[model samples]
Target: MTWLRALREIVRSGLTIERTRLEPLVALRAAAGVAIVIGLALWLVSPAYAASSALGAFSAGAATFQRSWRPRKVIALAAGAGLALSTFLGYLAAGHLVTFLLLLATWSFVAGMAWAVGPTAGIVSAATVAGMLVIITLPTSVGQALEHAAVIALGGVVQATLILLFPIRRWGAHRDALADALAAVADYARRLSHDPTAPFDAKPMMTARSAAAVTPSQARRRPAALHGPRGLAERIRPAVAALADPRVGAPAEGPGRDRAREVLGAAADVLDAAARSIRRGTPAQVPSGAMETLRIDEGDEVLEGPARQAAVRLASLLGEVLETADSCDTHVVPAPARGAADAPPLLRPTMFRLVPVVLRAMRRELHRDSPVLRHAVRLATVACLGYALGTALPLGHGYWAPIASVMVMRPDFHQTYARAVARFTGTLVGVALATGVVQLAHPDAYLSGGLAVVSAALSYLLMRTGYVASQSFTAAYVVFLLGMGGEAWDQTVRDRVLLTLVGGALAVVAYVVFPAWETPRLLDRLADWLAANGRYAAAVVRGYGDPAGQRRADVRQALLASRDANAAWGEAFGRAKQEPVRHRGLTRREAEDAQEAVQSLGQAAMLLETHLPERGARPVPEAARFAEALEADTAQAAREVRARRNPDWDRVEEALDAWEGADSGMDPVVRRGAELQLQALEELATAVDRTPLERDVASSRQERHARAEEEEESRRERDTGPAPPPKEEG
Candidate 1:
């Protein structure tokens, strides 16, 4: 039954598709690029050379489709260089079978380790492997090897040129990312307006943050042109999140709540409109009268004071974002602000100094406990085993087995197993379809090449839909691609299916024997999140005292660190939940409570940061003392979480009581923010103190019965009179 349940889950997950709005455009561009390059190569070059060149071009182009023009160029150059080197080495080693096998194994191991570097490196490494396999199979001398490598490099160059020619999509991607961020903000605002206590899911906001982060990497090369929209999105995220905080935006009853709801709704409408405008590359226009509600008279007090201020601030921020979106659409880079001489000089690093910094960062990952290191070793081992098995048996196209194994294995067991299943199933179905098409149509080289282009296009179209669908198209594409290279269709299909099965089996076995299970590390990851949030909260509270903006950078850095740590824990927890029952260290309910606690702490910290005025006004002495006490309490809670011990609830409650008493003479806004922070902290403490297991059933029942009887006795006393109570006391 357990196995049956697992199988059902795997199937359901594999079949679930996620559709994005821009996928069609991305797929169209990718298909056009690959098809045009392959067509030109076939027409201008020899048939065999064209096939090899087209493969390299298509692989590099596919790997870098989503990157900006600058990164695309960089990737193209890297891919070309890698392909040339692999092809030359493979050609040189082909004469000696023992040497060739050894070289292949070594290359596979190194390529497998490339996953440790990052996603871009992993893609480039895979492309190199594919190039080597293709080159080694062709009967070629040393001279021919150089020629083939040159042609392959030329293919990558062509793809890069095409990207430069068609750079419009880069801006489109940026717009879509910003729009996603704004839309997420709008959703959060709507939820908060309806109910302050409504459950807030940080996943959407986190996703937007990640998208905003990606834009900056590309902007480094063309800052003036690309940075404005990305920066606007980044600036707007915190403000929008702050507005959703119950503390910052809490309204009074009746007219106050009504006005608050109207203002929030209007802000959401404006944000959504701005997002739509950016997505469509049009001028942003707010709805008629939307901004009117945000304007507050000096004497007007219909909306609760702090909530009204928050709404006004949110409206102003939304206007700024819309203005930026308009500028982006018009391609007008905003001029740098006047009086720039008054600002501090930006600290720029020289390339020579930067190299060592990068090396140090990479070196930090070279440790026994690093997941990347462990996964790299596992991948390399599986690759070698897969290769050996393919060679030992009389399997045709033995490299496919190793390639499949390398592709299927990931850092975690859930992904590895899922990919293996998807790969095998998709390959089987794809081969059957391709076999039928070939037998019926008998496509010539040019026709087969076209079919391959169509298949590749469909693969990109459905890439985010599901692994099964994407891999199915990918398999069909490979079959057609090989046919263009003059392989027999029936034999190719059989070899592909058999080798994929063998490779997937090897991958599964490797993970079963030596798994990097996420379960055991879940506690540590959660603890890291707690500690990082604690530091973030403390830094934000301390910033209220720094009038010179001395701690502003520190606050931003701490927030980023906390976000990263939380994301890491979320990923680990997600993987842990997917594991077998016995393997999961914490139950789902326990994990949820832990995550909620961390999120509440983070929200409270963000609320403090947002409400803290610029040109910092001195907080009242009592408020200062309360801030210190809260900071201490947060630190203690972090330690308790790390140690897996119940936090001191009494101490936390005492601190809260002290903070409540210390609110005297504080600014009304400061008092409100402090009160909200105290409540959030209390919630965090409660969540942290909850044991994984519930109280004993018998004890709970007895306690409930006793409480009910006490309530009944009190009700009877109130109804009868106070005389009986007095007599009993005497």
Candidate 2:
């Protein structure tokens, strides 16, 4: 009876352990990896070890943690997880050196598969996983590789557990950064509107429009409950963006930084108001002193430097918005359609949309004359040299070829140079650390094995830090492996130093010779993006008369296109910072152009809708003349914009002249149409001045909505459905 009771207790414990130990997929990977290591260790081909497999598993788990923390589409997260887990399992099951190599290749293939399906998230995972796998599987052995595999799997499991259970506070930090940015934009807007001394030209308009453009979507996706202060920061990205208009230029009082903060603060206020409107289903009408709201009293306030400037700038922007709202003589436009038919033809196709063009343009600027490409070429050349030396030295392991390639190829020249220097320096330090551990401990299988675990831990810590940390760990692991193989310290040190110089030299050569130009490519890409957006905006106008179904389709496509373009521009700008002198102004002009186009399209859509009932109102020749003059000015604006990336002063003057002339001599109907067109042109000009795409898109949507509503009203009146009397136009 006692034995039976003990057995029952044991069974219950086992069941609980099985349920709580690991996720089913993860458990299966651990089990499978262990099985392969056991098989290979038994085979014992020479002094085979299991560190590589251990590293692989650890890396995969680390990737899983990275993915789970980000906001991703459901399919992306699932596919990314499956691919990473499967790679771990594959590495574990591969029993021979060739099998291990195949496993590494398979891991990359799987990660790529996920990337192919998921876009940004998938590609990032694939690159990291592939890079790590190649580093671990250098010698590629089936026999005696299980131990390495197990260590790697254990490291991975621990990392995954820690991230899932503890959750890092970094995401919160990012959120805060974004919030700070928003406050600055809002403050700037307030200043723009209220400051009597400030310029009332397109500069203020651009700043105000950009702020409004940036506030909406950013207010939607952030999760404040999870991130707290940091989340609040992220939620203000749009608000921060509002402060980025180029016309704001340098602030007069102190440094430009303070102005930026003021602008951001005003943007934040607007966002707060906008968010309230969204939540409560009530719109915040534009205020009269919106322009004055942005006025910065240089004499007042406790804040100094960039913070004060940013606050003032935001205040000005808010003032501007209020004024614009109060002065609006026409109706606000409705949202654009969310369908392809309602959007531009270029956007109808999901692939090769507007964004790529923008990206490509940015790329062209830097890459066309890129120092980075020269550096890459130099590095590739040096890698070939190392390969020759490694083989000639009779070490005959072509393994260093890829190592040299990986270590030297910087994403940019500065990074490449730093990494090369760091890799060589860290290699010396790592080899020394390994020698000290081996000498003091006189390593046994257990002691050497313990060192392996330590190496995994070090790798895990270094994993998120940066390239230097990763390289440091790689060197440490290599030194440990050398010790495990019973190599003499002196000989190991000599070989390591030699390879370090070889790798470093090779990398420099590649970097110098195979430069990857990033800027010019990005500019051309941005141009292409603008062209595509132009087409999409056009389609949206054409479909404005269609039912809600068509409008919905167009709006979605346009929104997606705009988003893609925005994201591409963000990345391109990040790349641009590396070569600001070369590519700084390339996209700035195009962005401005797109903004104007969006405004024009929006106003046109609204006017057409207003006249839908009056399409039968007949062409009043006087009104037609006014409309024609307005159209001519728009055409001239477009041509001038297309010819010059910056504001074409002559063309702008001509356009304003035409607009003023047309405004003076027109029938009421023509006058209204002319005014709408002029308003759109001004808004478009404002967008160009700001250089942010979001403002242009928002303005365009506003136009589309106005047009849609007008058309619907006309149809309803004609159809005579029960309806209220038309409200007086502003």
Candidate 3:
């Protein structure tokens, strides 16, 4: 990964157009909100006020387009309120550059650190900062500032009102998340029918869990169909896995295995039906043969032990799913996916209450090495520097520099660089085209306002397509906005383009200088994932040992922890792949193999979870000790991995060997499950088994070779800079 190649990749990615599903009605609805606000402002006040309203309305609408589980109207309102507050405060400090710069730096830092909460929060917060930078410059007097802020908020109000009046695809995202989870399980069943040891990606289930966390208002109104299906989906996964597993369910290459495949096919059909029903809000259309296929005959012995129990359980759960679909309009299920609590299960705090939660999250990221903290530092530095530089330059619209910087900058290397390129390229072409249109057409104030609204609408329409697409129209919208304010198109064009370039450069350089590479932390992420999966697996095993006393809450919490760890590892690995840094502790091949082993370990746990007995049923004395040993061993292994040492599974082995055949009537199913886990763990150890010294030496040799090639490439790049331009143009 040479700098030149990375640079090429960044540009290519930034310019790439993603084909997104177009939501025309939603786009038009958002546009209408902007139009209504602009019309009211123009009729009551002036075109200038209309511009302010449009900015607020459009920005708030834009925030709704971002991926979030919260209600869109709520997002619209919050975005509006945040924009109003930022605009008002920024106005108060606008007279003094020193005060304005201080405020800008603080706001930018907070916006940057908001990533600790989530991308939706971080992106919306950054949007607010961008709004503040530009909108603050408009109002002069205190009274005028208050009026501007109020009207800006009115835009959000309009958007929210439209959403309430004309609800399109209400609760659609939640339905899709649930449907996707069920669909994933259905696909797994189908895959397992062919290959019994197939792997299932956990993303869909994790997404469904995230979607299930609703605000109190959402919980009361969520449809009954969204309730129990997710939990049913969860139960179905393990049952199918256990049934298909040769070790626990059926013998391979025999009539038993054929029966298992038949059950799997029926399960897949029923799961797919349930998924479709949930997605479309219709009754489950279970296949005619599905139920018949699942029902075992009285004398049939195709499935025995844990496998038979799994079949029975899967059939029962699938029945409930079908019943749930049929009765969704009339009744709520007693046992909900989130437990017998809120209908939708997880009740998140209201927006007002989320302030403290977000604050605590940000506090945790205040450490020196935290990526969010580093990003905050970078954001604050670049913002103030860009502002100061823009002001020092002869460019008229100095705010463009910081506005570009704020909007383009992100918490990662790839995005920060890509977005910078996108913004600059978009602004150049967009500003030029808009300026050309204005110069040639000579549109009036009202026409310009209409054009601005149209531009904003176009930007909204294309938001999901790619950053570049939306940004191009966004620049045109700004151009039309300034035209409405009576600015000469020619006078602003050069300044807009130059300032955008300056801001983008500052943002890119800032990231390069204050880098937060994920390459070095690969081992840490891998260890965290291992520890989380271990906890989840141990909790499930413990449930078998102490079913009556087992709090399902423990399993749920461990499940969430594992999901978070898996996501962190996945995101880190993705970023690391694109990074132009040498992987030190682990090679790409080793890391990937280790991840597969880890995922297989989780899947093994899911297989065991299928056969968890009735709460008051007889407890397994052997499992309780094994669970303890598993917990202790994995924790130590995680520490060993972090310390760059080869992990030893001595405790895990001891737990397995400790009481083998001690009790003559011990559960064979539990023992087999333990064996599966042991096999997976040993695979992980094999994957990363190289000694620390050997790993280091091998990594160094590889790094040296890569560095020499990169240096050679860089030397050639400098010598042949002119030849690459034609290729770039093409």
Candidate 1 residue spans exceeding 4 A from truth: 1-29, 36-46, 66-70, 94-106, 109-113, 199-248, 336-361, 545-550, 581-585, 621-639, 649-664, 668-730
TM-scores, in order shown?
A: 0.84, 0.47, 0.91
TM-score computed on alpha carbons, candidate 1: 0.84
Candidates in order: C-alpha RMSD to true structure = 7.0, 17.7, 12.0
Model 3's C-alpha root-mean-square deviation from the true structure amounts to 12.0
Ranking by TM-score: 3, 1, 2
Cand. 1 Cα-lDDT: 0.66
lDDT of each: 0.66, 0.42, 0.84
Top model by lDDT, which number?
Answer: 3
Tens digits of per-residue lDDT for model 3, 1-730: 6667876775666456665456778999999998998888778888888888889999999999988999899999999999999999999998999999999999989999999999999999998898888888788799999999998898899899999999998778898899899899999999998898898888999999889888877777888888777877877888899999887887766677788999999999998888888888888889898999999777877676777888888888888777666645543334543332323368798999999999999999989779889999999999899889988998788889988998888888877877888888888878977988898899887888899888888888778776676788899999998888778788789999999999999998998899898888999999999999999999999987887988777887887798899999999999888777867778999999999988987887878788776797788877888889888888898998899887767777777666454563656677777767877777777678677675565455446435654664576468666333222235
lDDT of 2: 0.42
Summing lDDT over every window of 10 consecutive residues in candidate 1, give the lowest-scoring window: 337-346
Q: Model 3 residue 643 lDDT?
A: 90
User: Better model by lDDT, 1 or 3?
Assistant: 3
Encode model 1's per-residue lDDT on 286-346: one tens digit a residue: 8988878666677766644456666666666666666666654445345532211122322
Q: How well does candidate 3 score on lDDT at residue 21?
A: 52
TM-score of 2: 0.47
Model 3, CA-based lDDT? 0.84
